[model samples]
Target chain A: MKQSTKYMMSDGLAFSEKRDLKRLQKKSKEGWHLFSFLPMGYNLQKGEPKELQYSVDYRHLQDGEDQEYFELFEMAGWNHVCSEVGIHFFVAPMGTQPIYTDVESQIDKVQRLSKNVYMTAVFFVLMTVVSYFVSELTTGIVSSIFHYILLASEVFTIPCLMMVASLLYRKWVKKS
Target chain B: MKSLEQLTDSVFYIMAALVQPKHGYAVMALVEKETGGEFTIGPATLYTIIKKLLNENLIFLHDESNPRRKVYALTEKGHHILVKDIERRKTMLSLAERELRGGNAE
Candidate 1:
């Protein structure tokens, strides 16, 4: 069945096969396909029909089916909203999907960044508080819980920082 | 047959919508609602037109006190464009009218 994913706009930073291909090409004009494992099934096997219609239009397809998305935005006071839908349209020859970021995409990105940052900071501070207080109370069970929380937070800090870096690179470094 | 510069369909619709307070989506909605689907501007195009309108000072965003979506109404300059385009369209229609048997009905 043909399908379209409805990921929240905030979930944009996750790299797709399309994005990976573009990154490779940009890094080296003569980039090797190396290990092409893109998910749109863009590749061909012996005698398969040549690839077609791989490139995605980030713009709404304008078919009647999509009229509802157009309709919802019609509500008053929400006029400047750009549709948060971008697609990984595959192109033939050297099939590649360039990252196409628009305002809605950017908004999703900022929201994701802000939320992730806040969540991480909260988690870390909570652990720090627990670590300091649990030992003072001399309650073994509570103190163990605090240590575990601290360890979990230490594990989380790395991923969140990396995520923050990726978000920055996606927004600023690439745009610049 | 016409460059983007010459196409006034959107410009006219926007001006008409903005005669009263209408924002980006409202302009699109108003154009469609009023035109009965005869014309509908896509969101991308509508937002772009709004940016242009703001740049041209033909419309302004809502003040913070409004606590509502940004609505754009025409300025004197925008009104001039709307009027001119209306006349141009009317003149074109008149030419078509002259071709018919009951010519000059108006």
Candidate 2:
């Protein structure tokens, strides 16, 4: 019963969802099947190396319908691997139909994921602004150390937001 | 009731495939066959559409003795919509063919 696991960094924000899917597929072929999704990475278990087509569907599973949802995919021959919040991951043998068959549906899925990222970015930005104002009011000057920390928060979120915005623009406006 | 105009190509094909009760893979295979391999619905899209169709009463799950596969069939509303869409396509084709024939006569 020898089992081994590895902590592989996965994009939790899902901004690079397509890349992550490719990575997962490649990893699965190398005998690292994803067994769990941690906050900052994926936990993969050692398994027989096989070619698998990994797909991620950004959907908010409603209560009481989770079983049926999985069942539908299972019936379609996709094996459910794991899920993180609104993102569900599945893998199937090569040549299995993609989760999204049309451009419109693919765009819809990306839009939903982008919306979640946008809201999260907004929350982080709002928190930083509020904290900055509070610190300035209390100390009569924004503390340099805390200010840097707050700015660092923006550093990651702003770029992530930009990535999502550009992705949506490319798909919708440019029709790429 | 959802408008027929709102039904995308994938939804339309899935509904057509369900004229007879079918499981997920069967619907995919039927759609591919009907379209001459021009269209294929993936598992994710099919699953989502199935849920939407069920919610709209356009389709219902058929109870099958085999518990492994869940079968689905078109409801009356779904059949009516499919028939209407087919008629619309036929009418459009007739107009196009009439123009083509006129050009050939010229």
Candidate 3:
């Protein structure tokens, strides 16, 4: 028999991880278990209806660290679901201890994510600025090419800056 | 996590468990058991704290024969820091206890 699957659009984790996790939990109750991550969403496969709690952790595992890192979670009652980029998803029975129990370490997790987002935002901002300058200082085709580049960069820059702003606000809220 | 002059509760608990040379899971189990479930450290937090302690030279890998379940123990520095934190906690506890008891006596 063919399997049933569906795609759920994410609101961009930088903006809505908690909402995504809650949605995942709700989907699990409806027999749609998260199968894997999509570029901008989740691929869920229909399965047994089970109530579960989902948690996400961000870590850049080094060589030879995956085994130990995963084993620890498994032993602690969280079963690994799927990982994409540095984001790991896990599911356990409801009321399982959260992946982060302390504010200091939770802040560390946010900072790690913030660092990556900040870098991307800065890169796009630079690209936008450079292209703007080139487009202004040149003429004809070269200027037009830079103008297009400038437009693309600006397109990326807006969302990236918004993400960066949210991240900064998150860090500030956590610190205070 | 950055090395802080003061150990957070999670760090302090993990370090206390490492005084016996336990693996990551063991530390979690021990803390949960000892605290009667009053305190627990999640796996990611445990792993992060373990890495931070190792970086600060507060903990040392005691055994890695299994690779996947490497054991850790408190270093001399870790022991010293834990001892100091215990003293600090004791002071806090005694002050609260004395005040509470005096109020009750009244």
DockQ of each: 0.05, 0.45, 0.77
Q: Show where candidate 1 strays beyond 4 Å.
A: A1-176, B1-7, B62-68, B102-106
Between candidates 1 and 2, the TM-score winner: 2
TM-score attained by chain A of model 1: 0.40
Which candidate gets the maximum DockQ versus the true structure?
A: 3
Best candidate, lDDT: 3
Write model 2 residue lDDT over A1-176, tens digit each, in one string: 56588878976545566678788889989999988887677888898998998777878977755675677677667888898888777889998767777766666667677787778778777767876766665653456666766787777677667866766675675245
Report the error of model 1 at residue A58, Å. 8.8
For candidate 3 chain A, which ten residues in a row score worst on lDDT? A165-174
Q: All candidates' lDDT scores?
A: 0.49, 0.77, 0.91
Chain B TM-score (each prediction, in order): 0.78, 0.82, 0.92
Rank by TM-score, highest first: 3, 2, 1
Deviation in Å, model 1, residue B45 alpha carbon: 0.9
